[model samples]
Target: MTLGNWFALLVALVVAAEVVRALRHRAVRQERWRRFFRLRTTSWGLGILTFLLAVALAAPLLAPFDPNRQLDIVHLTNRPPSSTFLLGTDPLSRDVWSRLVYGTRVSLGIGALGALVAVALGDGLPFAALVVAIGLTSWFGTSRLVRAEVLSLRQRDFVVAARALGAGSSRVIVRHVLPNAAAPIIVSAALGVGNVLLLEAALSFLGIGVPPPDASWGNMIADGMPSIYTAPWSTFFPGLAISLVVMSLNGVADGVRDALDPREAP
Candidate 1:
């Protein structure tokens, strides 16, 4: 019923999922999927992400209190946490912890959801368009490089042998060309998450992101500006949460990239 209990349960579920995945990785015979599981770093990064998401999902129900509600002025205005207010009370006497918790859901939710929506929409026409542009620009930038590499690989004895063995051009391209050419693309895409979150935060901070009735960290800071000196926690807590989530995402993404790319080297 309480926030702590819900958070604990969520953690337990994630741990259980991880254990099951670990067991499956050990027990399953699928070599392809097994390779994925063997990448411990990816799993670790994903676990961090999943926990962040769980906190967001439970925000509405388990926030310390209604973020928008004005608290009783008699108790504590701009009060640091006491027996009554866990994290602290803001200028308006609203609970800083509760707003921060719920705002996590809003800010992260909008950032992530907006990014996914943009990506999803782009995956169709815009993506195809970008693919074309990417194909063109990439060819412009690295066509020479890709060609040199491909030509060198082609001259390799194994490639010659495969060609002599009747492997089609398609097979050669699929097996060789793509594996080498796709890495940059994946890396580029991975870099987009931070930019997307920043954009979302900017939008929210500008007051256009999520309308009121929603608790966004950016918007919270925006709302707190006028009273910030009087009650800095109102600004600090939400801003800190936003910064942490965005930084966490960046860290996780970098970890995954390093984990997956052995060529990055020890």
Candidate 2:
């Protein structure tokens, strides 16, 4: 009936789906995923990211009040943090905590979705037209990196042996070249998450993204500027959320890069 109830229902459904997926793939070892979080930095970043995502997902359950609901004018405006309102009220007398939680969903969702789609497509039309918007942008760098690696790899003794055994170009590339070249491409993708989030925030700030009624970090900051002197907390929390997410992503990326680098001794 309430917003929290709806969120609880959604969470239940998500859990159900995950259970079904796990059962369907029961043959697959879960260690593969666990290995990814083995590094201390990656574990910390993932822990933060997981917490944020949990907060966002359970926003309705956790927020003390609706993000957009204005409280009684006499008592709620620009109030400092207290038991009644943990993070204090915003300029509009809405719950700062609620808005921050919802805004997390908006900003992180857009950034992550955009980056993943763009990276997965590998410079396809949608990758350029919607996500990154370019002719040869991040794609160019990744392609060049892969090409150089492939070129060097193709000259290796293993590749020569494969070719000598009548392996087709496609077979050699797929079997030998790609497996070796995958590391850099993966590292680049991990780093790109931070870059994409920044771009999403910029777009939201400019009024072209994650429109009103739905809180996003960029829009919240934009909205708070006019009343910043009177209500600084309104802007501070969302900005902090953005900073944390980006920093966490970068930390995870760096950890993953180091862990995967061939030059690093085990």
Candidate 3:
């Protein structure tokens, strides 16, 4: 695998591990899971995200052709969807279906990386400067949300009890404050993935994203712009992918927020 593919695989593994760990937690299993699954939107969103993640993880095995391979510039370029090419060929004659499959890895990998950086550092960097820039621009809202949650939780009786028990600040913050503050952070991260994906696509469209020969939804859309009328599938498929992912993420975020809200009736 190429370095980018390796990095994407690593990120996917780390995310999967984290998810497994989270699922094994008592609170997540008993409370969060119960409430989260109560919402139909959450179920649908989770299903869609899971399918996309699976597609990304299985890209090498799933993609029919190399994303960067141009079959024939003269004859195959900008061809409409056919039995051979599922989505169609782009201006470069690369398989759109193949690129779309691979692009899932790029889009989700970068989105997950950016969200992690934003949560971990409040504002941070990534392997791609574009990812870093998206995280930096997006962290403030999450930071504010977390800061509010932390401040409110700090004044609670449990935090006071922990402080009285001589727990160190770091221990108290990690065990007491952050755990209670986790719901909003988790929701923010989920929502942030979609935002980061959109931002990355925008940057890529503007010629500063994933770079050529490597397929990204943004660059794919940009490449299709000139031939949009003749070959609308080129732009339509990628844009639809983006929209579906973002909408699914938003649904999940809203469900999570509702599920975690103390004010909500059980």
Q: Encode model 1's per-residue lDDT on 132-229: one tens digit a residue.
A: 33334333434555566677677778678879999999998897666654554344444455455565566667876555545667777777777788
Candidate lDDT scores, in order, read 0.60, 0.68, 0.78
Indicate the TM-score of model 2: 0.71
- Ranking 1 against 2 by TM-score, winner: 2
Question: Which candidate's TM-score is highest?
Answer: 3
**TM-scores for all predictions:** 0.61, 0.71, 0.76
The number of clashing residue pairs in each candidate reads: 0, 0, 0
Report each candidate's C-alpha RMSD, comma-separated, in the order given: 7.3, 6.6, 7.0
Kindly report the root-mean-square deviation of model 1 from the true structure over all alpha carbons.
7.3
In terms of lDDT, the poorest run of 10 residues in model 2 is 126-135
Clashing pairs in 1: none
Candidate 1 Cα deviation (angstroms), residue 49 = 2.8
lDDT-based ranking: 3, 2, 1
